[model samples]
Target: MKVAPLPDDEAQRLAALRGYGVLDSEPEADFDELTRFASELCGTPIALVSLVDAGRQWFKSRVGLDAAETPRDVAFCAHAILQRGVFEVEDASADPRFADNPLVAAAPSIRFYAGAPLVNADGFPLGTLCVIDRVPRSLDALQRHGLEVLGRQVIAQLELRRKLADLARARDQALAGVRAKDVFLATMGHELRTPLGGILGLSELLLEGPAGGQDGVADDLRAIQRAGSHLLEVVEDILGLAQLELDQPRLRPRRFDLDELLADVEATVRPLLRGRAVALNVGRSPTPVEADPTRVRQIVYNLVANAIRFTERGSVDVTVAREGDTLAVRVRDTGVGIPREKLALLFRDFSQVHGDHEAELRGTGLGLAISRRYARLMGGDIVAESEPGRGSTFTLTLPLAPAT
Candidate 1:
């Protein structure tokens, strides 16, 4: 008996076969059905969907065969894979190469064999869909054609399985990257806040000392205070965003009055309007809500502060009222209205829409992003409407009930 030699492109063919990840896999119904069909069409007692591994021929699907695999040296399918078309041995017992082969002389007593090479899209023959008969016989033209068609189907199934696995791996990798980014942001935010708090506290104390009355000295200290305060705000926004992304935002909910919360937010942002010609007008009616007051306050403050920064000489209006089962808080600014195209960037992290006054109104661009996250976390959302020169309105809508 003659042993089948390896293909000319043995390494590449093996690599291509391994890529499918089908070797030694459990029998699948799709492949089993095809093997059964091949056996019936060829009038063979034994049929197989065989994959040739480095040292063995593993049967992915088999009919009338008890063993799962056979050594490659004695595998009839091994020789078949080297051929482009069907390889047929009319009488294996009479053929010199397989007459003395163990498969022909042993238990199954194979006397006839026909196999269609399973060739992939890249033209690598991975294995075969083959049939065996104990009695000497040959498959007609139609039977040979049917066997080749089934072989192509096997290759198609393998290709599909590989593609699905690739997509799953890609999705997992993208999710891992997002988690890593969140962790890094959370760590760095905490690290920077310690020093920033000290700077702001020291600057405040210096400004209250004898330097408070010094003209140039007081101005310098105030500048330091302002920069420190802005940096601290940015760090806080980063921490908030990272916490939300990590899905660990611990919200403490309680029953609170929406009108009173708005009042406090108004007072907090009124100081920011000291130099600008913006008038802060807040309209409210008594409204109760069940949610985290701290998060709600932060969202409202962000919206009001954002409006004041953009409006150079216009009115910023804050209004709150109940609409059915939800409460709506609208912050409308007469500042340079956002361009229609830039509206979508308002709530995306690190994304900013620049206008004529963007230089003076520059920010970390995380305020709106963080606000929207908090609103949604508590069963609410924020939306914007604007006309280019007429100003913009950001409305925060929240359900009156606590979030589940």
Candidate 2:
């Protein structure tokens, strides 16, 4: 419905109403409860805390009303909002302006109407708190005052909801920004690793062959190659994470035996378990899953690596199993568990849980982040559970393709 241009004061009020940012949001229980009580107190079949926008009147709360919004031109509350005080019509049938209105002509034919204008935080009249009835009735002075007080309450609720929404949006934006930075770091790491790997590979070949003469020189060269290779691995992990953040990374999916993959991940991380008095257990059912083999390896590697890194005196357990069309893998460690506050940041790039740079524990803080990215790339998810001073477990869940 086309509403006539609002007058100067009405326009200002309508702008103020929209500024609250409460229109078209989900129904809130706090305002709904207030309106429900008001409806009961006034003994009206229909009651609403309606907010007037440019072309419509929306109910923040409603009782005994099917419609959530109605055209402003045909709204009884629209006319009611023009005054600062109470607006009442004894009977719509007696008023020419509303005589032919659909609410008056149809079922639940509105006859009695009483509305109190709602004002914004700045005291600008914006909309109404109204009660409607089929039978013409008059409200006592106390009821009128109560409705006005309830209208003020509704306004307060709207303002609070608006503030909450604003805060939530800000939080989301901040997270997005952090995710972007992670992507950048990951990309640079990848680019640096590719070249570093080549340099390390060449250095190793030289140290092993006739190019190295003295034993001491050979040891020095081998150390350089090993250190470079480790750094290169770190760089690659960071780059992979960055690409994953932009959602631009592609995985090379292939059919693979789940049991074999689990065995390989176990073998790779076994060296970390030596002399720690910790046992490593691996369990995998003979399940085949279609996924990127390389990416899956990275996923398993990260989880197991993290388990070993955090657990100093206890065993790390790995499990892989399939249920129906889904594959599940879990890595459990008995070590110093992550704190509740730090658990959420585990998958965030460069978000290190350990604050002190102790010699025994060293990490780049990209393991979990990269693991999560690879899992998601292969249509899977990773979740964690941890309790401080006890242990932590990371679970990876993935979908399996059906047999041909």
Q: By lDDT, who's the top model here?
A: 1
Top candidate on TM-score is 1
Error of 2 at 362 (Å): 17
Candidate 1 stretches greater than 4 Å from native = 205-215, 233-256, 263-286, 290-295, 310-317, 323-326, 332-358, 369-395, 400-404
| lDDT per residue as tens, model 1, 335-397 | 888889999999999888985446657678898999998888888899999988789999998
Off by over 4 Å in 2: 1-5, 9-26, 91-102, 105-107, 207-404
Worst lDDT run of 10 residues, candidate 1, spans 354-363
Q: Report the C-alpha lDDT of model 2 over 1-404, residue by residue, as the tens digit.
A: 22334646766776787777778878889988988888987899999988888788888889999999888888888888777877988888878878888778886699999998887768787788899999888899988988989988887887888788889999899889878777667577667867887887688678668867677887677667656755765776656665666566767787777787788988877755643777889888677787888788888887887787678887899887776678988899998888999889999887778758543454677878888877887888899999988899999887786686
- After the best TM-score superposition of candidate 1, give how far the Cα of residue 339 lies from its true spot, in angstroms: 8.9
Q: How does candidate 2 fare on TM-score?
A: 0.50
